[model samples]
Target chain A: MLLQQQLDGKITEQKDTGTPLLQVRNLKKYFPITSPFGRLKGHVKAVESVNFDLYEKGTLGLVGESGCGKSTTGRSILRLIEPTEGSVNYRGKDLLQLNQREFKGFRKEMQMVFQDPHSSLNPKKRIGELIEEPMEIHKIGTKADRMERAMDLLKRTGIREDQYFRFPHEFSGGQRQRIGIARALAVDPAIIVLDEPVSALDVSIQSQVLNLLEEIQDEFKLAYLFISHDLSVVRHIADEIGVMYLGHMVEKAPTDDLFANPLHPYTKALLSAIPIPDRKQRRERIIIKGDVPSPIDPPSGCVFHTRCPFAMEQCKSIKPEMLQQSDGHQVACHLYN
Target chain B: MEGYPLLEVKELRTRFSSEKGTITAVDGVTFKVDYGETLGVVGESGCGKSVTAESIMRLLNEKSTRYDGEINFKGVNLLSLPEKKMLDIRGNEISMIFQDAMTSLNPVFTIGDQIAESIIVHQNLGKKEAMEKAVEMLRLTGIPSPEKRVHEYPHEISGGMRQRVMIAMALSCQPSLLIADEPTTALDVTIQAQILEVINDLKEELNMGVIMITHDLGVVAEVCTRVAVMYLGQVIEESDVDALFASPRHPYTRGLLKSIPTITGDRSQKLHTIQGVVPALDNVPKGCRFAPRCPYATDKCMTEFPLLETLENGQKIRCWHHQEIMEREAASDVITAAT
Candidate 1:
């Protein structure tokens, strides 16, 4: 009651396009390990002090290898998992401070689409009911209105309305992903965190899904937090790309700038390792020397120094801050300094 | 194309008996793998590329699988070989590696014991000799500090090192033929590159005839000398790696190549995708299997099946309208270049 009273009438106010739709600062999510009996063992710092902003209709792509906490970062932003420390500012309001009942009101504008569409949807529910369940929970419309809106969303997502009555198991992987996208858009969300949306689909179906996402983002001006491991897919959709390594945002730059001028040793190694489709366009591959260090007791100072080819003695002892490069690009490596 | 191949598979058909019926996973698959050459079998899942590999290895259970073909490995017919003889040839003359090393390697045993077990079985070496050779094999796969890693279990090592351990076990006996099925699929890209480089280097050192099975065309372009594109149960197209990418003869192959987003190409355009998904294995098509999703499919394609015919440039295609495909692709090439 006090939180709502503090907000008063400003809760529903819309901000101008000049401001970022979402601003996250010093975000961290550390899972504490417990001993078999009861005592705290250690901490798995899955995500540590990440910061970024998403403008209206903008997508910030997060790229990293498996177990790098890209998925954890996305989940933390939506408060699916409680953050250890950070401030998620939405139009000047701090989301981290919101209580359970207060955050419920913000759920309409913030949603997430998971990686595996097969497991994300309820197997028993019809596609129409699945898409309409969100609007019904939020009480945005009546039964009839929700059904009509569900049909419209089905059409928008390129699924036929007649097929909406079918169960989840009846549809193919790509079609199921489309239904997943429609469900995310059911409550008219301003921002959606898509976690490896196309990784499960085939190459051809992956393109179809990516094109649909681009089209929908343009139509609704939706801000997206697209997380994927494939650099090729991330470059096509994201305006700005952030490279994560052992829970750290090692590099951040515009998509074109990141690919063309990768400064971080880990980022450069990742780019060079991607296998080119064309046989003739050959380039030297910089295969990192060793496997990724364990996140439990990650290498001190810099997590990537174990595999980095250009690691200096300072990288082992002193941690580097995310320092600014030219024109919004940022790199967290001692070589840049 | 050259002298006698180290291994040749002809008219290879593999069928599994299910509750529905007997479904032929690989039908009339024919290919030749030369010494020191890598032949990439590229396809989507359920496309029988892995079945082709397993069929050659005779790894599938004979009670459930019925195979019809001649898998001649250096003048020996693998199909008609005795069980004892086949056992002798499995790891000694030919070897196999799987995709997920975590599941493939035994968790209870140390990496050294698992690798040494193969050497003991194949080379008839005793415990001490095989253990020493296991370390040497692990070192050959580029595992650093092989002496220490030899005592570690599969779970203690990283995924990349586990994959390298699997490779070490597979190559310990120095088999002349190695069949690697998506060996690097479970690793990260940099680790995948390292594994591929190691595989290529070993292929040269051992002069092995490798049948590399994977779904990645990029991996195919990087390491494969020749490529075979598989559809539901057959090789749809086969050519040199350069030629297959330059002028893909089959519609499915061409569509597969175009669907992947290329780093060198323009990002403004949407990818060209095949219209439909792969048909179910139970519902084997009556005619050209890919006809339903192929744009240039004709009435004749729906009724008559095409055989694999060798093209003028040593490329092989299994399509009735090769002439039309050539013409249409050439015209589209000019259109794309003009734009």
Candidate 2:
């Protein structure tokens, strides 16, 4: 009875309580390509008019293939890179409007865990120092308090407190990811954008980190903008999933719904390609016809039209708008029309 | 000995004499690939899947590595072959495709020239004949407009196309066996399927054996005739594709199978994730390498490593309590669903 009571209390605490944490509207980030003369010649349309609502204490999985601008979208939300266009509202305040001083305070509420731990982490600094530096920069607590917190965070992330003094080289890939997670948690951010956090880790190690993330999210009441290329991992963690293709969210649905009956041809094709482990029940692989179109000079109209199996002539000339085809299910395809 | 395997590795052990110590990447791993069959080697990173493939091709740096095993290719022990003789066997009799096609292919050279080089090196063909053969190989791999694609550099083509080029080059010599190490890891699913289909088609055409080393089980089901599940430098489970998937003997293999999100199953449910992390090479557990993470691990399992035991119908397993574990797992699933 006592254990049941405790579980119920934890479950209620895990429920989202705060207002919508982030609201991105028609966001676009175009990185200018420079010429040999060091002048901005052209732009790479990385994130093109992507819109999504991230509720407080809720995870939103942003999934896409490489060069689909998923990472760019994550970075743009944090203003880690200035958006080329559109508005990002955090806690009802315009994030782009914040100046250097305001942005510093905003940084405390939001943090990012990168894909590659070694590259993101300071090679020279100890793991303890790495975790401490964030707290130090933000001036969260006293020196002794910060050190204690760092040790606790390390333990929370499944890393040994004794290894705090060791450099990044001393740890393995999974341990390094723990250190990365520890550093992200040091800030005590309300939201953490995990960009392919477990992609670099082994499958077994991936489960550990994922389970850790879920446990920590429950304990800390944290929200996540989980971005990854892996659909299976995303299905395990994400409540709501948005499928990105060539800088467009072609489909957005609840994880189960999307997987069960994907409406969009592109989404169906993408799902078909995932190698399920069952040998007896084989799925007819709906191979997308061509590679992802280059973002530099994206095709006019539907970006997925070139590869989509059911692409009509209308799809090639007119861009389809994201529409609510069902309850909480949105798709951007002419087939629905 | 009467029915000879196309390629057989007997007690294969590849060790690297690093400054720290002699680290054995592939230790005492034995397997076989018969003609017109696909052997899927599945394991996580550093589990020596790629290393096993590399050792087969003798691609590992010879200066720092030591090989002790009989790699019998068509009855000849490749480990004892001279460099020149091994070279004759390498591209002529057996070919290998790497993970990254861009890195494997030279950027400056056209696709035709690169593939022609392999044909010229391995076979007694003139430049024109080699170029023509390269086009035929490209066509065989399902590269549309091979004549035009042949003139393009590695950078000019797409990633999938680049992989097709690599396959074309590999099959140009019409090797009896082909080693593909994560050939589609860098490719998208649609492209991966396309490349896989091309390989499958050519295998049937040439009667060539293929060794596909991948972490993805789905790929194995799609192409492989047999599979060997590796864990911590050992083949923990090996069986036919059907039996391996139906009733996986190893806990790790079962965990892997369950962890995968299948479309046919209840997509609403959470993934049956394996509980722990893959231990690092240096910190590999003593008894069963998977015992630490395994749910059904007993004291015997923790203290003694089980040898690969042949089960019903030639299926091999390296687990102490596989039967008991499967029963418990099945019961647990039912109990959980009821609740």
Candidate 3:
């Protein structure tokens, strides 16, 4: 199917049912360099033509290595960073085209939980007051009303209400993360961009946060663009997974489908490298030859061609279009093309 | 086992005097590494894996640090050696590669000069001879155009190249033992594999004993000949690589093995994560340190910590209920695997 037809089909599908909470198309964010004279220099392609959709009650796992534009994509969608190009359609309204007043209204519905819990939360403020500040910014209710909601959110996120007056340093790593989650939930956002929310956590505590995320998703009917480098957590939480390389989405498929039959060579290499605990079932490790090339001057055609084990000459000259090989399985590889 | 072990650590305890109190970072840990063998140390953060490596090299701050145990490297008690004597043994007999390659490498010096320093220090080689040896070491580490790359600073090279340089400097003396503490944790997966392969090749070429410390079990499976599973600063389990993976004797080890997401199998199955977090140093459990979290903990397990007992095939286990737990787990595998 052509790209236009696939997009139209998705729109009709969403219209036939209910609208998707968030839809992103060709979103690009580039960091501009300034010359010594403070003139705008060439831009760095932090995120490039990324496309994905998060339904009303589903999680879309945006996964890649560090500097693969996962965080930039999240920040761009939330409009925390201005995109150099593309459309962000949230609830049928193009968020990219929204004015400041309109964008402020949309901000209440979209929130972000950052990677580092230790640095994300304010050290000076009490836990309750920190959570209440969001409500204060939005001017949602009276001071007493905001505190009551803050206490409810704190209790909901598995923190003691009595400890609400305590500082963030008083809590453990896991608890501090929970407080971060509570602060994000204070605004009652419909969509949450969880940026490496559990990467800072221990493996044992990671599961707890994951379980909590699942529970919150179920209860509030939340949509998440879960960005992370860890594939295991994405498999556990996301319904759909987008595998990014350099600054492009190389593959997007259901978690199970992507895991079972990864189409892209880069995806295959990544999967093969993950160490299975069981020693009996040894995998033929596909050792990719070289390191990831510089993103500023990414390879002309397929960004992954440099490290791709099965790269052809054509892969070096022409960019492969994102083509659907199966239902919900799209890959941008010359082999697939 | 087969040939003589190159390095052996017996009942090693590394303590530090913190502002809070005297804390034992590594408590009564013991393991051995045969020549040309990679013994992986697997544990969570603050589980004493790094401290064990630091203790072997005597790298901790001496004023606030206290060590109680024997680190017998090539028949010499590294603990009893004087500071001046240890300087000879450090890079010449036993070397270490730290986690962050960028921070570990001196920014002011070129890669060649850094590696050459070790050669000059350990061997009586002149600067020119040391430079040639440095290029040889860099080339051995699989770096392309080692001679050209040697003159570049640490910042000039990629993370992978910097790590290779670190490996080159560490093995410049051809140390019988190499201690790597999360060497590839900062690099991407592809680079991580390369670093692991580099370490493996060097271990084989130099006939060196390698102690690899990492939290990722997958890396351990790929490289380690034997594994010592540490928890709360103690070696909870120690066995051959295959045996440890096949039948983990300790609950912590079992949980760690299960917790790692296997790329080979079905993705639908829920990962068996260990329930609770690692207890803080001051809040050490009165009984088994893992008793608060272990699913198989009983009244006996809650009252006293189990001694490290030698099981069949010389596998060491620090759990009182290992026999019973193994039996129950075997029976439940049918149900667990189906799910």
Candidate 4:
């Protein structure tokens, strides 16, 4: 009854759109390096001052190269890895400030779908049991009710009802990912943090999963924090995109706006790097020089200054703040300034 | 060797004997690569694209793996070559760069030592001279300060640099044929572009024939002169790169093209996905291998296997309904244009 009431309240509240479902501000996650004897070495600043808002039923894509801390930012929002600083406001409540007992109540509202379907699901457990495990922990329904709901979720996710008893090992990578999605939906989450969800699957399988995600997002009215390294995949799903580089959000804009008129140099280079399949439409690629630097001791000021083709003297010293270029388009680059 | 192609694979069939049964990984695959040309073999996972490359290089374990058909390199049959003769031709006449550079390189040896080892063995050069050539190869790959980077261990350099070193080592002997199996799959997009550029530059300089085996069509479009689409261990389609992308005759090829969400793709419409997963190697289909997943599969497709027929435009298609599909596509294109 309480869950129904919460759902009803959310439906009414979503219409107003006054505040975001989740508002992240100045989020930072730093991992400390230590010697064998536990002497403090240096901190690997994985995420620094990341900020974004995920409205109800919206999709936010976090994209970057490896070690760009896109995954770190996603984890930090859920407090899966405790954030070193900043606030994660969910419906006006700060998640970072909530204690373990207090946060347990909110955990059901947000769930995560991990990458690598092969390793993520336990080999021994049946697919049905995996979906029901979340509901059983949350104590939402009785045993019979949970089983029915699990079956419904499995059916909705394109899995056969008869195959519910089969183990994860029996399913393909795409099917395993559907099971992962079904399990996430079991808790009835408002926001799902998907980390490189389709990168492991083939292109044909990837499209199926992508389509399934879109369908589920509409049915459940769920928001997504889609974290991936593939720009093309992100472009297809995300409403808004946040481009990160060396633990900082270099640019954030609506998907179409970002791709059409990318303001940041890093964003431009990243956009151009994607090899388009069309033989006729060969793009003028920006081909940025060198690899991403180590995030432990990132370059001063702009982390991307070392790689930025338009890097100026000021870019090496003074950090560029996220300045709004136009409506809903923000970029952190000295060139924009 | 006057009129012979640099590398020509004819009716190649590679099978592996497992505890369950024998599975044909590369079934009757055929293609050719001339000097200064790239032939791209593209397919999804478990489609035997990698197996085809490994078959060409004869890298699979001989105890469990069996090969049939001809792998002719400059008019000489590589499949018939003795093990001792194969060793002489393997790295010296033809080299391969694998997907994972870190795993492919020796962790203990410096990049210089590794590259020099191939040069020393192949060119019969002195250790010092081979090391100098290694640095030159590294420099040719566009790695900055090759002299300093040459001495660094595999772990000491970045992923992009390590890949450059791998390319350096592969090209140190200046092989006429190079087989790159998903060389840039593990790399970041920016780094991938750099590596692809290096490969293209080197290919031109050496006038080498390259066999690029990857699942990514984007890479195929960027580098390949010709492309072969594979499905369930069979080459479904083969054409010039331009013709392949412009008009993919096979249903699997069409499905594969529509499936990928390009950077500039229309976001409003849902992606076209190929129904059903790839069948397991053990459960190989009887008739058309792709008939189970094909949208255009007919009763005839399910009952009889289609031969890989060559079309008038030099395109090969392994589908019974290729003509009908082309006509339907043309009609649809006209409708779209009228709208």
Ranking of models by TM-score: 4, 1, 3, 2
Evaluate every candidate with DockQ and list the scores. Answer: 0.42, 0.44, 0.43, 0.59
For residue B145, what is the lDDT in candidate 3?
A: 92
Query: Model 4's DockQ?
Result: 0.59
For residues A108-152, what per-residue lDDT tens digits would candidate 2 score against the true structure?
Answer: 788999999779888999999999999999988899999999999
lDDT of 3 by residue, A1-337 (tens): 5545533432333233356678899999889888999998777788889998888667789988878999999999888988999999988899999988879988989989988999998899999999999899899999999999999999998899999899999988888899988988989999999999988887777767876876687677688899988787787777789999888999998777899899999898887776666778787878888677777778898898887778899999999999999988999999976
- Candidate 3 vs candidate 4: the lDDT winner is 4
Stretches of candidate 1 off by over 4 Å are A1-17, B1-4, B335-339
Residue pairs with backbone atoms closer than 3 Å in model 3 (clashes): none
Error of 4 at A203 (Å): 0.4
**What is the lDDT of every predicted structure here?**
0.89, 0.86, 0.86, 0.92
What TM-score against the true fold does each predicted structure earn?
Answer: 0.95, 0.94, 0.94, 0.97
Q: Is candidate 1 or candidate 4 better by DockQ?
A: 4
Shift in Å, residue A93, candidate 4: 0.9
lDDT of 1 by residue, B206-303 (tens): 99988899988889999999999999999999999999988888999988888887665665566677887888889977889999999999999998
Displacement of residue B18 (Cα, Å) in model 1 is: 1.6
Per-chain TM-score of chain B, candidate 1?
A: 0.97
Q: For candidate 4, what is the recovered fraction of reference interface contacts?
A: 0.81
lDDT of 3 by residue, B1-339 (tens): 245467888999888998899998999998888888889998889999998998988999999999998988777788999999999989898899999999998999999999999899889999999999999999999998999998999999889999999999999999988999999888877778788888998888888889999988878888899998899999999899999888788988877766655555444445677876788876788889899999988998889878889886989999999998889888898789999
Q: Which 10-residue span in candidate 2 chain A carries the lowest summed lDDT?
A: A6-15
TM-score of 2: 0.94
Query: Residue-pair clashes per candidate, as listed?
Result: 0, 0, 0, 0
Model 2: residues >4 Å from true position, as ranges?
A1-19, A38-40, B1-3, B260-286, B323-339
